[model samples]
Target: MTASLLDRLMDLETAVSYTTPPPEGERPFTYQAGDLPILISAPHATVHQRRQREKGEEEFTGALAQLLAETTGVHTLYSCYRSMDDPNWDRVSPYKTTLQEIVQSRGIRFVLDLHGMSNRHRFGLALGTMNGRSCPHFEPLILQTVKEQFQQTSQGTAKSYEELRWNHFVLNHARFTGGVANYTVTRFAAEQLGVPALQIELCSSARVVERRPLSQWRAPFRGQPDAIHQAVILLQSLVAVLQAAI
Candidate 1:
């Protein structure tokens, strides 16, 4: 293991119980911090285990999250869905049961879920939740950070969410459509569980095409690296915000 991985764990509340269990032949283990007030979870990670896949969006963000981790002294993150699992369409397997068990066992405060959209509309980080269910003012701060970062990266010329049009139809629909658990995790994790939650959707064009005007992700995050990096930055930045929340 790398030394930085060790550094990722210090005051963390110790994670346990993944959404799925791995069999005897898994390559390795990918874990996250469960109970910290700031929980950065990426639901579009991959299958790292034979029967289980554990990872999050903040793992790779051009080393920005790593820098934040060191500067902020943070330790905890989560991922429940593989790139193939699109909770937006329907919630097939909600780790909510597992998350509930963890939250009840550990008492987590906030849940920040990382995701990306292919809707041809969204552009920056989103603070979508179960509708006025969480920190209502979350979007403003998230937008501020994202816009600031956009200016810093020299990555894209896309303005903040305000400058673009947003399809807000999927704001608080916790109940899955067609049994596919797309936004179910965030909805349940925050609304049902009473845990303040945030869902961030990154665009796929920047990651897949590596060009301007990121295309909205239609399916799942099958091949998107840039989106993952952006997710990481958002997660780490949110962590800092949580540190202030407490």
Candidate 2:
């Protein structure tokens, strides 16, 4: 089962090269349309440039986003090549522009912007709602859904919630408050598009099964398969509950 999951992740990340651009005329991001009214975005899935500095790719975020879309039938967008600009940081970017198009055209009611964080942090998952300004109406429901999902045992895994070590899930964390001070994708989707949005920052241990071969800049490490399984189930549950609510 772990091997199958890894193979799926590898297929999703095959085009994600930090140093390479997609063939000429192709966009840097891939958008998968789904029947649901929700949109899942991973803007920093590939290496991105912010103010002339290059930021490393958020490993496995793209794969997770794609997997969520596949499993939940929700709209998905993720960067698949070196980004000329930071979609989550810049005030203006092609990524944001495309997102606006998607939301408007697809009648999207909610947006979930996925990101990656270092494992050094105490929390396994950090949810940011721009201090309750982004998803004001759905904050309580969203929080409740995440907490409940994380507490349940993951399918196909015998490990209990405590054994998975994913009990730490925080909201509006001081370090990751949904880019309230910056031009984040969540902020753009909420403020500009008038859509409820949340920024979900997952620790490396919770999101990645293994770093892709192209991402050699990151340290060598493998995430526990059980933790990855639980994270996937949690996100799937969150999407299902949110879809039903909205």
Candidate 3:
């Protein structure tokens, strides 16, 4: 019997889930070694706690990282289980400690942290570069490439999204910009690791084509083909931009 690609990704996630907490003293993030200088990460793919409240999963970021690794042959890291600490928010998150080690050991030059956002936002995507402090040299290239990709991919899609093209690029907006006072994962990578990093926030519309209600955030929805397809296009677009930067 043969299993499909989606099945393989699911199996991978399940296997990672089992070893999430580790035996006693193991790292929280699973690091997959790759030859490329890029390290793709999905830190919010699972349920996590932040300031005493339980946060919902981003839905498909784990699968996106896996697919990017399989397709681009790049290193990937992701949180496997419900995190005891918010890796992106907590300044002392253990995930950051291990991330520093990985960056040093693997000589990673770039960190691409993937995240998902609510569809209530105007744009389908948002790039956070900590106000050009993260990746000053490559930020413009990243922005240009992403816009081009979206325009190209949306040729056959809906036209109601025209507003997105005009107001899509939110440069260092107030929300999730990784700017000052924000000790996010990408910020740590840029400052401590000395590597350029960008936080890519994807809208739910681009992934699952629906703004999932908060009440249903915990439910598993990995088998959705449309969501997976959208993720692939976005991943490929980012890969192209990274390759150019390299």
Candidate 4:
């Protein structure tokens, strides 16, 4: 199963070259429609430009989004090519525009924007809801669900809740407060589209099975299979609960 997961992620990683845009007529992102009212987005899955500066890809976030969609039947939008604009940082971009269109047309009620953070952070997962401005009605349930899911032991996962809790799980940390200082996809969907949104940032250990070969700077690192397994289960649980409640 872990090997299958790695292969699936690699397939997504190869869909577009990390340093190049898609063909002239192609979009930088791909959207998959699903049965649930939730929309999963991974805007930084590939290299992106912010204020004329380039930012590295977030490793496996795109693949994670796709995996979530496959497992839970939730709508998904993930960047597949290098971006000329930062969808998460920039106030306006084609990606955000497309997101708005998807939410409107698909009657999406909740948006879960996926992102990745460095392993140096002292958290397993950090959820940003703009300090509850976004997803106000569902915040408590979201929190409860996350805590419960991560604490439980699934069939094949090797990590116990105690082991996973070493880093911790947090909500609304000042550094990643849903980009309150800027217009993030979470903020945009919540404010402009009047849809609930949450920014779910996974620590590197949870999200990345292994860095792609194209990554240049960081020494090659592989995430524990147990951690990845737990993450997948946790996210799948969130989607299941949200779909039922929403």
lDDT of 2 by residue, 115-176 (tens): 99877776688999999999998899988888677656434355543444565788999988
lDDT of 3: 0.70
Which candidate leads the pack in lDDT? 2
- In candidate 3, how many Å is residue 55 off? 1.0
Candidate 2 global CA lDDT score: 0.85
Q: Model 2: residues >4 Å from true position, as ranges?
A: 1-3, 153-165
Query: Which pairs in model 3 have colliding backbones?
Result: none
Name every residue pair that clashes in candidate 2. Answer: none
* Residue 179 in model 4: lDDT: 75
RMSD vs true structure, all candidates: 9.2, 2.3, 4.3, 2.3
**Deviation of model 1 at 188, angstroms:** 0.8
TM-score, one value per model: 0.52, 0.92, 0.81, 0.92
- lDDT per residue for candidate 1 within 28-122, as digits (tens), equals 22334432455445444332222233333222221222234445554333442233233322334444455566566666776665544453544
Model 4 C-alpha lDDT per residue in residues 1-246, reported as the tens digit of each score: 877877776676665356678789988899999999999999998889999999988878898999889888999999988899999998989999999999999999999999988877767789999999988988899889886765564433464434555237889999788878899999999998999899998888787777777863368988766677777877888888788888
lDDT of each: 0.43, 0.85, 0.70, 0.84
Q: 35 in model 4: Cα distance from truth in Å?
A: 1.4
